[model samples]
Target: MPWPVAAHRSRLLLRGRILLDLRHPGAAIEELREACGILDVEEAADAVRGPALLDLARALRESGAEDGETRRALLRAQRAAGDDPELLLPCLAALAAFHDAAGEAGEADETYERAVLLAPADGALRCQLLTAWGESLLRRASTRDGAGIVDRAEYVLREALKSLPARSAQRGRLQGLVGSALAQRFRHLGFLPDLFESRHLLGQAVRAAADAAVRAEVWLQLGRVRLEGWHHAGAPVLMDALQAYESAEREAQAAHGSDPGSVTAARARHGSGAVLALMGRPGAARSAYTAAREQWQRLVGALREVDWADVELTRRVESEPATGEGRTRAERELRDREEGDWERVAPPWWPWTGEWSNWSEFDRS
Candidate 1:
């Protein structure tokens, strides 16, 4: 950790961080590799090496590099961190996130547990780790064994929220995660209380959200909560749900570029279609579903030219094309509509019911 060498490595790391923030992962990866290379042969550069290696791993992952390299770099960072909690905790968090994204639930849980245990109880790092851990659990909350996981996720995110200030930058995001977890719990347990609480929290998240993308997602979740509440509680929440979906659509359109914006917009349209179907508006529902389908097709067409970095999107496009059986079904539905067969467009076998699962891919925060 010589002063001159440390300063140089610090400059490189800072530049790499800025590049990564700007979405220039390729350039970030190069700068971070150079930073990590600075202390490669130095026996006492462990302090510098840990953070540099972690940044390198992040940049590599963002650049779509091979998973092996990313994992190796993370492991090296942990080793270099030695007994330093400041460095080790971040390494653990990143490693946990990597495991979570790879669907290794067991390993992710273990790593997150270790990080939580090591992080100071009231520290910002603890909140950050819990947020990531909760989000990971939330992502898996739709699986068969989702009941317990979603409940745990709710508790974790709530605890994280307790450590955050009311108007903190991360508060809205934490609230949204908690709301999502509760919403998933309601979906699993059929509890009206959970749905109500989820709607409340998501509303707060929407109001507090600083980023348009975050607001869009919160609004979308709120719409789902409202729709479910309307169905079960028999309240006048249908219009409310439609409003939320429309809000989400606008926010997503304004917040993102072509690729991700199209995906979010499609989800919002599908959500609107669901609400319209529930409102007994068959024609409107059909139109909304058609718009959603078209948007998804457009997204697939755009991504077909490039390698899809999102595995879920790739899976959907490959397995659930709008052509073939899907197109045939659409044509039959259209003919039914043309023949004034509104009854056939009702629930249980409608387009939204049949294809909602495929169209419901959500973005991670």
Candidate 2:
């Protein structure tokens, strides 16, 4: 490839990343696909082929492409990466995240381990990989037989924090992850010591967070710990949890420039509602729940309006239409998924039916 041609492809890759960040995944997919196609045609383009495929995979994921397509892209990138740790580590991390999302815990764990072992002694990249692995563990810890997972998550996150200086930018976020993992353990065992330590670490995280969005999440986690404390202690802890939730709501709103439909804001509002109900304030709880419902409704409505079909995937499927019945079934499934995305996205705490009976037990308590 000539220098100018290589530069042009680089520019396309950069533009695709920018579009992805700006939430234009469909456009990003087009730009990245062309860049990947350019590299594919070159006889000796292995140097850039891996990165181009990786970018294309990211764009496809953001565009809601099928898991199989995304997996194939990642696998291709991995093969092209061949022995280059710089390229291979990222491919591994993305594959780990994909496997984690699909609930393939063994694959996710193995991939994360490989990436971690291949990483250099210490740096931002190593820290990031550790953090991603820890978070994945924390998520899995929410399921059955999770006590061991919590311990592993805590160990992994703490190891990442050990190399960081006090004022390092990642300190607050790592602290938050460690705290959350400990909180999960506390829930599992009703261990007051874990609860106390989690509260303390999360408080530090909130104070040290460089980003408002991160601070908001820390605040929310702090509220959860305090609420758990209340279950064991008393009313004072309940009030403290309520204050944490209020701070979370404010910080979440500030982080997104007061976007009323922010997912974090909705979560904060839902937390507030739960705290209010626990505090025997039915009217206030109802008001908070109503606000959360409205915010979630806006988000759901926006998602429903998106055109989820990937143009390339659609064309390929269309080209091989063996029977009309097959196309009709595929169409029906896509429509069903779009219609039910809200149910999949919404948290279990969300009031799906808007019935006061859903909270009657709490009210009576």
Top candidate on lDDT is: 1
- Over 230-279, each residue of candidate 1 has an lDDT whose tens digit, in order, gives 55675535789889888988888888654534566677777776566555
For model 2, state the Cα shift of residue 173 in Å: 2.1
| Residue 359 lDDT (model 1) | 7
Task: Look at candidate 2 and tell me the lDDT of residue 123.
Answer: 66
Per-residue lDDT of candidate 2, residues 267-353 (tens digit): 677677666655545467567766766666665676633112222222232233222233443343243335652232222321111
CA lDDT, candidate 2, residue 28:
91
**lDDT, candidates in the order shown:** 0.70, 0.69
Top TM-score hit: 1
Runs in model 2 with CA error above 4 Å? 1-25, 28-31, 257-259, 301-365
Given candidate 2, what's the lDDT at residue 141?
78
- All candidates: CA RMSD in angstroms? 8.2, 16.0
| Worst 10-residue lDDT window, candidate 1 | 351-360
